[model samples]
Target chain A: MADTQRPLSPHLQVYRWQVQMVSSILHRATGIALAVGSLLVVCGLLHLAAGEESFNYFKSLIGSPVGLVLLVGWSWALFYHLCNGIRHLVQDVGLGYGIPQFVRSSWLSVAGSIVLTVLVWAYVLTPGGAA
Target chain B: MSAKDVVVKDRRNPLKVARGLGSSQSGVGHWWTQRLTAVALVLLGVWFVVTVLCLLHADYATARATVAKPWNALLLIAFVLTMFWHAVLGLQVVIEDYVHVRWKEVVLLVAIKFLAVLGALASVLAVLRIALTP
Candidate 1:
């Protein structure tokens, strides 16, 4: 009995791709990313608290090309998670439960996040603009 | 008496008792906390991002002064705590779902809690140090 093989439940391979599925998965994926990003926040705070020299060094690290790439990815992830998280909160309040609404909201989260990421980056890259 | 008439107690598997229902018996506490932290994070997170953006072009003294503002310092502390709380709640679910090994799951879960606690404390101290500095 200890060696008995139990049947496995249906997995992602069996299901057709859908907006809801993608949104759900992305929520978790971006969550993990943000968890890592939080460390950077801690690092920034620590450096800033240490002194101007340390703060400048921290700024340089983040201003480097590789750092910029990671920052871009992190910002996009933050936007996506925030948008999708709002959708989830709405669902928690008992709205948007219908299939059509669920799908629509899923897509809305995706689209809204992209729009936000673009807006933020646009401001970031513009001359004399806030990053 | 026949075998069917005998008063034999039927033992049930413990796992079966918790099969459909929540095991912790906290009855939605975890779910509610996750949502509450999420809502708090939404407002705090927006403020935090904007604050960071404002600091992008700021020099060290300027950035320090910005963070030293009473309102900014208060909200920064609020943001750090809420963000870490929400993060732990979310990560716990991810670990529970994916880490099938019982020992590994428990260790990971406990590890995250400790890490979040340490991160929160360090962040708060850092904020206080910045805010109180001349």
Candidate 2:
């Protein structure tokens, strides 16, 4: 963005991608996704307050294939953001700053989020449905 | 006319120099609040998910009854407030990062705050209605 047209420092395409990078990017991506997902929460509350018919309509919408897919994606996003968010909070407190520890924690966040998503879906898809 | 006067005239204002720090003093406050809300949401969000899952197959009356429980109603309201607060903070940062046009960015920033307030209020009102009615 200078008059000389020199290449920018630390250009993204020049660097090799790493877990730390992916984790950082996912934090932003998932944050945006969760923000959008909040609308669904509002809708659910509104529908429930409206009456039985409205509530059932909301339920059926969520039970549909497209809705199920969105739910799965949003849930994974929520878990990813949650796991990475904790890692970020830990880092904010001055822990896990070393290169080795940071990289390890990055991978931990990713794996932990996946495990959580699987566990949640397992519960939701099971017989009793989280009784 | 004097050398001292020339030097003073050429120097930038101290307040202007400080302003160049670009609101760094408030950065820590923002960071801390985001983390604090994250911690709160971690607990509240997990509880909410579990509660909703429990209501997944419940009939209308059962769902209403579950929300009508005092503790459930309180936590739902708390969750709505915290979630929207955290969300607006997060979205503000996202917009600031990607939207460089000053006027548009300011408009969007203000608009999101208003919309979030409305969303949070509406959600809380809906919860109260379900809890208090019949």
Candidate 3:
């Protein structure tokens, strides 16, 4: 972005991909996505507040397959952000420094999020009498 | 080393009342708030998702009942408040970074904060109305 067409510093192309890097970058990305997704929550809430008809319409829309897919994506994004956000909060307190600890924590966050998300969908898929 | 203290060519200004119109170029405050809210959301956000998931597949009445429960309602309120706080904080940074038009950026930031706060408040009220009602 300077006068000359020089390559950017700390660019991703030159570096090897790592879990910690993925977790850190994805955390911010998901945070932004979840911020957008929160608007959907507002819409849903307002629709429910508006009236029964509006709430039913909103329900049907979100109950559709496409909506379910988006919900699933948002769910994962939420979990990922939550897990990595905690990792970041820990880092804020001056803990989890060093390469080994960083990488380990990154994997821990990824695994935790996945397991938690699966458990959530599992609960969602649970039938009435199957519990 | 060149010891030349050159002037900022157009650095003169009329003796107006206040300083510059907008915030200064020292942009650390936005970054700090974003991180602060991010820290709070980490805990509140996870609790929210897990709680909602547990209520999944439940009927309308069951879901309402779950939310009406004391502990669940408390966490729900906490989650919504912390979430909007984190969201407005994050969006403020995004707007500040991208929206080069200063006035527009400021307007959008203020608007986002207002909307987020309103959203949070409405959600809290809805939860309370549900929890307190029959």
List iRMS for all predictions.
3.2, 3.0, 4.0
The residue-by-residue lDDT of candidate 1 on A1-131, one tens digit each, is: 11235533325777899889999999999999999899999999999999999999999999999999999999989999999999998888899999999999999999999999899889988997554
Point out the worst 10-residue segment of candidate 1 chain B by lDDT: B18-27
Angstrom error of the Cα, residue A48, model 2: value is 0.6
After TM-score superposition, the amount by which residue B42's alpha carbon in candidate 1 deviates from its true location, in angstroms, is 0.7
Q: Ignoring the other chain, what TM-score does chain B have in each prediction? A: 0.84, 0.86, 0.74
Candidate 2 chain B has its poorest 10 consecutive residues by lDDT at: B16-25
Residue-level lDDT tens digits of model 3 in B1-134 = 34454644445564352464446544567567767777667677667666655645545566667777899879877777778887887777667655666688879988998888888888888777767876
TM-score of each: 0.90, 0.89, 0.73
Question: Which should have the higher DockQ, number 1 or number 3?
Answer: 1
Judged by TM-score, which candidate is best?
Answer: 1
- In candidate 3 the C-alpha lDDT for residue B53 amounts to 58
Shift of residue A126 alpha carbon in model 1, Å: 0.4
Which model, 1 or 3, shows the larger TM-score? 1
Q: RMSD per prediction, one decimal?
A: 3.5, 3.5, 5.6
* TM-score, candidate number 1: 0.90
TM-score (chain A) of candidate 2? 0.90
